[model samples]
Target: MRQIRRLLLLISAVWAAAPLWAEGERAGDFDYYVLSLSWSPTWCALEGDARHSPQCDASEDFGWVLHGLWPQDEDGGYPSYCRTPKRDPSRAETAAMADIMGTDGAAWYQWKKHGRCSGLSAGTYLGAARLAYGAVKRPEVFRKLPREVTLPASVVEQAFLKANPKMTPDMITVTCKAGRIQEARICLTRKLELRDCGAGVDRDCTLEDALLEPIR
Candidate 1:
């Protein structure tokens, strides 16, 4: 009994330290992403000019999400710079920013947005805790500066593209953005639809689409 108790305690500690997205298959009907993990103030910046508005004003703070599993490389995918415990070799700039902004005593969790309950099987992480950076107002200098940030959708698309670069743009990209943004008036964009499950399928017939749509 003492040994069993010790094992349970150890398991609890590890589970508490790990992100919820660390395990499980995120089907479109139900999926999850990490909103931010160890995000730092210096990490705040616009990733790129918005696709529609290159010069438009925006700022983004980036972090990691283990899409299908923990230590993503083990899933037979090329590892992302942020997924590994160590610094990313390719994105020196992002690595630096993440480090500077990484010291906050923030805990990470995968928010489950109940899919079937909401007419969408897909669930996403909604950050319930606030970090210093999350709630603080940025100074003017910080406000307008271009920061490197990547949306979960961008990461998802990139992974697919890396695997099949020759695949048509329409064939590979999954468009997802944060359900919640900073604006009080702006409601979250409802259920993101992922296109391109495979060949010859109707673009709108994806599981995400079906799940996201209200029951008729």
Candidate 2:
């Protein structure tokens, strides 16, 4: 009886850990999407400039750039690097995304990490990503700033909410990194419709005065 009970307990333990072990094993098995729009100037100030990335070049004039379209689980976990039989995108295909993504490399990386989990082919995923990026209305107000400023992170969220009437407070979040405004993450359905964020993605930055750099 004791040996049988031990075997039962071992089985239960493995079952409980199944989700973690099987993460990214299946494709297209997510609840929703999180569209991350990164503040370009802030990224330059933090990391881009250091790397001498061309996205930070003064002539680039980038504002909010498409960071990634991540598939999320309602339970706050996300799948990534899932196994897929799709062919990788070509150099031209990734380069085309540079206008919105800032670099072909970023586009390729997003595909490798999050896009594979979407169960879509590389071309289809990139096309979906472009459509999703176009769906969001990036507020022109931020780009009009002639100089850097510091404001509550909530202000960024409000700007998005105002520009996109279909989006509510619960549907978007402002995140900060190294005391600078990082990204505005918006929740969306698989079809790209606005939706409330899940618990993990709902974490809004509490910075009362986060730095926002102007477009260079």
Evaluate residue 86 in candidate 2 and report its C-alpha lDDT on the 0 to 100 scale: 76
lDDT of candidates 1 onward, in order: 0.26, 0.92
Q: Report the CA-based lDDT of candidate 2 relative to the real structure.
A: 0.92
Model 2 agreement with the true structure over 1-216: per-residue lDDT tens digits: 999999999999999876532246588999999999999998888889999998999889999999999989999999998877777799999999999999999999999899889989888889988999999999999999989899999999999989999899999999999999999999999998999999889999999989998899
- Tell me model 1's lDDT, rounded to 2 decimals: 0.26
Q: Give candidate 1 regions above 4 Å deviation.
A: 1-94, 97-167, 174-216
Pairs in steric clash, model 2: none
RMSD per candidate (Å) reads 17.0, 7.2
Q: On residues 1-216, what C-alpha lDDT tens digit does candidate 1 reach at each position?
A: 999999999999999998644233332322221112211221222222333221122343333211121111212232121221221122333232232233111111111222111222111211212221243222232233354333333333344345434433443323222321111000111222222223221122112221111001
